[model samples]
Target: MLDFHMVYTCGYWSGSPECGLDDAQQQKLNLVCRNLNLKPGQTVLDILSFAKFAAENAGAKVVGITISKEQAALVRDLCKGLNAEIRFEDYRDTLGEFDHIVSLGMFEHVGPKNYRIYMERISGLLTNGGLFLLHIIGAT
Candidate 1:
């Protein structure tokens, strides 16, 4: 289960200390889009659905994938009227090159055994000069 506001990942609080949870989450999304230099009509492969709506709002074509059908449905509904597609699929099964790839809070599920393979797959999916942002919880 996630928070009541549907924010499942950590927030980026450095930008606005006085912001509430929702604002902080939105700030994090904006920061990622800005750092990635996403442009209008660019294709973005979002491993998690968190950035789908935000990327679409920034005028990018977002393709968000999640292993859970429920999550996919929810994202699809939330992203209505935007250039976004949410799918219930695994990242390894994803195809097509993207101008940007973003994975937040999903790497931990890949585990150490599949880390290299996951990186290779992500690399292969990215187009030349494409940017990738991986935000994960590292080991202690």
Candidate 2:
């Protein structure tokens, strides 16, 4: 199982110092998810989610994917009592016919060479009116 300490330590979980980089990143992610206009009962895809907070907060059905099988299982365990489904798959291969898609701190793992491909893949999964919210960090 993947240790959630790294993810939970981020401000997204709750409290954190203003100087926390993780907090800043999570703030950006939360804003994007909220701006997506997620609705309850909607199918939401969370690619490479570590905490599944956005999906849970939206009160939507979630399909979460992680590259690590064990980590995916952990996510499944965490969401066992909730309306969430967790799986192990490369984000590139995951299927999504969702009303909303949210991903945070994951796109950076995809090299620039694969960024467009990743974007295209996610875009292809949306309904004509679906929204996709991505929180990415660019190198300074």
TM per candidate comes to 0.90, 0.76
At residue 51, give the lDDT of candidate 2: 40
Residue 22 lDDT in model 1?
71
Residue-by-residue lDDT tens digits, candidate 1, 1-140: 24433657787776555777777677777888889987889999988745455555579888999999998888888788888888888998999999999998889889999999999999999999999999887878
Q: What stretches of model 1 exceed 4 Å from their correct place?
A: 1-5, 15-17
How many backbone collisions does model 2 have?
0
Q: List clash counts for every candidate, in order.
A: 0, 0
Candidate 2 Cα errors over 4 Å, as ranges: 1-30
**Clash pairs detected, candidate 1:** none
Distance from true location, Cα of 73 in model 2, Å: 1.5
Q: lDDT of each model, Cα atoms only?
A: 0.81, 0.70
